[model samples]
Target: MDLAARKYNFIQELSSIDENLLEKLELFLKTNQKDWFDELSIEEQKEIEIGLKQADNNELMTHTEVMNKFKKWH
Candidate 1:
């Protein structure tokens, strides 16, 4: 069968699958996919880690606050 037909058949088959099997398929796809974060530079990774830490510490600013702070520059 052609690729489009195969994908359509696979999606149709997915609709009949049980929740446990669906969860397994989801996990399988996630593990098999290439993560974009893995391509980031060390400095970029560290910056993300810092932002995550700040978030965990409740140090995040609201969208309006951030926009207001940077709006002067624009």
Candidate 2:
């Protein structure tokens, strides 16, 4: 089929999906609309890479640790 016909068919098929599946698909598209890392500056990218490395090395804080640290202010 032609590109326009294919797109129309695809939209028709998508319209037949249940509401929950449609919502999930919309959420997935919105979340993945862009590669967030591509929009970051060089320094920000480096900081993210460093944070990821620390996470891989188990050099990260636990949820309880974070809560405890902030408990005083709350």
Candidate 3:
């Protein structure tokens, strides 16, 4: 039938399953595989890397400090 009916039927069938079947279902449900390996662009990736380095060096301040700095920037 429709998507909602199909999903509801799947959930009902899943709930009726034994513990072994549930375990197998759990693996399929928990797995997150994507088609793209590198989702971020080169620039975005570099920005993330730079942020990580800043954090490692303790150059990134606390939340309050960041808020104060952001207000100053404006």
Candidate 4:
């Protein structure tokens, strides 16, 4: 189904839910609405920072180069 139709159906379902469920759903949505990066480990964040710095410095290799370099792993 399309997003609009799905949203309408979801709203219809939400209308039938009790106040307690609606409050819990609201809290769930609010608590879960964090940036994905904020959930990453410190090591992962450092690795991403390093990659971004390398990219900014134009220290990138081509897709073919990366695939060829790591081909043996597969």
Best by lDDT: 4
Backbone clash pairs for candidate 4 read none
User: CA lDDT of each candidate?
Assistant: 0.97, 0.95, 0.84, 0.98
Q: Judged by lDDT against the true structure, how good is candidate 3?
A: 0.84
TM-score for each predicted model, relative to the true structure: 0.49, 0.48, 0.64, 0.51
| lDDT tens digits, residue span 5-56, model 4 | 9999999999999999999999999998989898999999999999999999
After superposition, the stretches of candidate 2 with alpha carbons farther than 4 Å from their true spots are 1-34
After the best TM-score superposition of candidate 4, give how far the Cα of residue 57 lies from its true spot, in angstroms: 0.2
Between prediction 2 and prediction 4, the one with superior lDDT is 4
Task: Tell me, by TM-score, which candidate is best.
Answer: 3
The candidate, 1 or 3, that scores higher on lDDT is 1
Ranking by TM-score: 3, 4, 1, 2
For 1-74, candidate 2 gives per-residue lDDT tens digits of 99999999999999899999999999999988888899999999999999999999999998999999999999
Worst 10 residues of 2 by lDDT: 29-38
The residue-level lDDT of candidate 3 at 52 comes to 93
The regions of model 3 sitting more than 4 angstroms off are 33-42, 62-74
* Sort by lDDT, top down from the best: 4, 1, 2, 3
Task: State the lDDT of candidate 1 residue by residue for 1-74, as single tens digits.
Answer: 99999999999999999999999999999999987898899999999999999999999999999999999999
Which candidate, 3 or 4, would have the higher TM-score against the true structure?
A: 3
